[model samples]
Target: MFKVRVLNEEVIKQVIDMKQVVGAIEEVYRLKSNEKTEVFDMVFHEFERGVADMDIKSGHLKGEDIFGLKVVSWFKDNEDKKLPMLIGTTMVFDSKTGMPIGMLNAEYITGMRTGAAGAIGAKYLARENSADLLMVGAGHQATFQIAATLISMQNIKNVRIYDPIDSNNAKKLAESMKELLKDKFLSKYENTDLYDEISKKFNVNFEGVDDLEKAVKISDVIITATPSRKPLIKKEWVKKGTHFSCVGSDMNGKQEIDENILACARVYVDDMNQALDVGEIEIGIKNKTISKEDIICEIGDVIVGKEKGRLSEDDITVYDTTGIALQDLMTSKIVLDAAKEKNLGVVVDL
Candidate 1:
């Protein structure tokens, strides 16, 4: 009754595939819409204001018979000590027995699940013929976002990356993505095969851009994954029928798009309460530019057919992702299941 499996980042990398994780996330969303899952209120704390912070995200997946919590922290100066700036740990429990079943490193799961969320947003909300994508922010998360997008949306033929802090970051990420697609360089079988097939079939192009406005205007889909506190994209620059997956702004003060965009767009959130508190739409709601009623519905609602996504070709759609706990919980189960089949994790008596 006290045995627990331990999975480190390395083991997690071997067992969890992005394609499977994407499917898991899609199921989680549907479960959420059907009231079969519950995401508890996220608890956030800052070690030092503006320097470091931590968040505890917990949820119950009643349909899956599991529940879990993920603790993620970000330390701005951790690089000075040769530590990753972002670190996370996730604990999973059996719902029926209420016993801890698994513990694992959460960094990879965090990135992949969030990437899937962004891609799913585009899949449901973006125009059917959407081809060009502009990624706003060229960080580690940006790579996963692009990979998941390519895996989910085969129509995307061009990807442009922009980092407000430096153009070099965008250039580096562009090169890395191009190499990844060309070589099918991932360890996961499904992802590797998909990348290889995509590279051979599509003339995919990746570019690093300095002109954010021009990139936004021409792109069919724009995904932002930065940690910016101010708006990096303007409302006037955005064209009609464009879809935006706002992946940043998971904190009280962080923002990426102008609030004016929400005024005219059909906005959807991962969770209404979390979105109003810390998502891309938070600023707009705070400034009275948009109210809670402005949000059409949760993305899960659309996924479950409870609501429509992208009502018209001329309608702008925005998905405000606040990083829900249900995503981590569902993805953890996938990793745990895979690890068990391959006998890839360490088992310890608790």
Candidate 2:
């Protein structure tokens, strides 16, 4: 057995820098893959129904160079302590036998995979001419969303960010991203109340519209990464040809888009069974906002060419992203492969 410990920020940064992770995501759509979305509902009660506290424990048991267990915990209220809102670790095992091989932090992997999912969705669903982007909630996930979008959409010229937090942190994050990209991406950060400023900005026109509605109305591509229990993006706000990538609501009762949106849009889920039971799609079904018949395709189906993505430019599309274990497995494989090439991990026999 061998062991490796990847610190939180370092793993997150590694995930940020790994292009293979994005490639893996693109492959996921091609694998005709199915997601096994599971949740320990009892655990939510222990965490106090807090979006930031919902713990996701998962593992990937198949595929070459992909065998690991991961635990993810979200606690957004701990920022005062300089702690990340989401944190967790992963344990990789040797596939030949049931032996442990290494360990790594999973928080970063989760964000990257979620963001990559958005990018993949945009690649298939967003208009080819889509240029402007609107992002709701500027956090770790938001950063990855920007990264993925920049990589996937070559024409994206401007990105508008809206968050309720103070302007200092938002500006700092934006600046850091700008510097990291060497000014290849242009981002505008605003401290305006989401509801109040929605109408003024064409990219984020929320005026005369509620938060959820306004967010859906202004942009060709809308990415919502909040931890809200109730709906944040409504159906009425979404127009024809709009593409939505929702990453915030992964657990039961946690939803970011209105149920009505699911009813009308060409909805695609990372995993259908998982979405039907615990993902946002499940919540919509339980509330009767959408029927099981409303589902259009799974990410894999679209990737494999088995199902159609956006048939026309006027279609409304939504991709509900419930973080998947295979994502971490693939990302870890990429990192571990790079580490092996660069002699990055300390190897020991146990």
Tell me, by TM-score, which candidate is best. 1
Model 1 per-residue lDDT tens digits across residues 1-350? 58789999889877776677778888988998999998887788989987999989999999999998999999999999999999999999999999999998998899889999998899899998899999999987887788778777868889999999999999888877866644332445544546566554335788999999999999999999999999999999999999999998888888999999999999999888989998999899999999999999998899989999998999999999988888998998899999999998999999
Misplaced by over 4 Å in model 2 are 1-18, 32-56, 74-85, 164-177, 183-216
lDDT of 1: 0.88
Candidate 2 residues 1-350, lDDT tens each? 45553434453453245244567877655553534322223233246554456544555534453466676666757787798766777776666676766676776677677888887878777888776677777766777787676666646656766554544545565556555443222222224342223212222212111243454566788887876777766666777888888788776678877788777788998877667767778788987888888888788788777888888888888888776666776666676666666665566665
**Which TM-score value belongs to model 2?**
0.79
TM-score, each model?
A: 0.95, 0.79
Residue 32: error of model 2 in Å? 5.1
Highest lDDT among the candidates is held by which one? 1
- Model 1 reaches what TM-score against the true structure? 0.95
Q: What is the lDDT for 307 in model 1?
A: 98
